[model samples]
Target: MTTFTVNGRTHQPEGPSEMPLLWYLRDLAGLTGTKYGCGLGICGSCTVLVDGQAARACLLHVGELEGRAITTIEGLSADGMHPVQLAWRALNVAQCGYCQTGQIMQAAALLAATPKPTDAEIDAAMSGNLCRCGTYPRIRAAIKLAAEGGEA
Candidate 1:
């Protein structure tokens, strides 16, 4: 059993040590907010926060994360009203909504670290998160709006 903290709660996930954190989070820990777009780490759809830094869950192994704190989209806020979330909503960032959770989670972490990120920073930071709906422009606008202390 590999023990890890998730969404402010402790979880003893049952699986192979090499099991991807994304699978552990979804199948074992029951935290589905961190999605799985691609099994590989190329897509940022399974983005989560490990000690407040955005990481690719699909790339992290459960065994390597024992005792670490993992924060998923569900942990970003209990009410879905976090500043970044609000900004995303205000900017209408979602189209199909399939990738919005990961997008929001990534944005939350970015805002936490760079409260006032520049356009280049936003582009660089969010470049890996692929939105099939092509919501990149709206996502960028939302990040800017959130940094400015209001919804987009």
Candidate 2:
């Protein structure tokens, strides 16, 4: 069994170690908010925080994440009101909305790592997460707003 912390709670993964964390979270754990897109690390749809760092769930095997703290979008805010979430909402960041969860989680991780990220830093950090609907400007604005403690 692999023991880890998810959303501030400890979890024991009983599935195969090679199982991707995305499957464990959605298939076994039922945390569906973490979206599925490219299924590759290329898209950030599966982005989650592994030990407070941005990680791609679709590619991160459960065995690799053992004993680590994983934070999904659900863990970002039980109240649905994290600064990033609020910013996303205020900016109307999603068109398809399928990738927003991962996008926000990635942005949250970025903000956590760098409270005040420059435009280049934000772009550099967010480069991996592809937005099909092209909401890049809004996402950038939201991250900046959230970083400044503003309500989007």
Give the lDDT of residue 22 in candidate 1: 91
Looking at model 1, the pairs that clash are: none
Best-fitting candidate, measured by TM-score? 2
The candidate maximizing lDDT is 2
Instruction: Report RMSD (Å) for each prediction in the order shown.
Output: 1.1, 0.9
Q: Candidate 2 versus the native: TM-score?
A: 0.97
* TM-score, every prediction: 0.95, 0.97
lDDT of 1 at 82: 86
Over 20-125, each residue of candidate 2 has an lDDT whose tens digit, in order, gives: 9999999999999998888888989999999999999999988887789999999999999999999898888899898999999999999999999999999999
* lDDT of prediction 1: 0.88
Q: What TM-score number comes out for model 1? A: 0.95
lDDT of each: 0.88, 0.92
Residue 134, candidate 1: alpha-carbon lDDT: 92
- Ten residues in sequence with the least summed lDDT for candidate 1: 7-16
lDDT of 1 by residue, 1-152 (tens): 77889988988866588989999888877788888999888789998999898899999999998789999988888898889889888888889988888888788888899999999999999998999999899999998998898964
Instruction: Tell me how candidate 2 scores on lDDT.
Output: 0.92
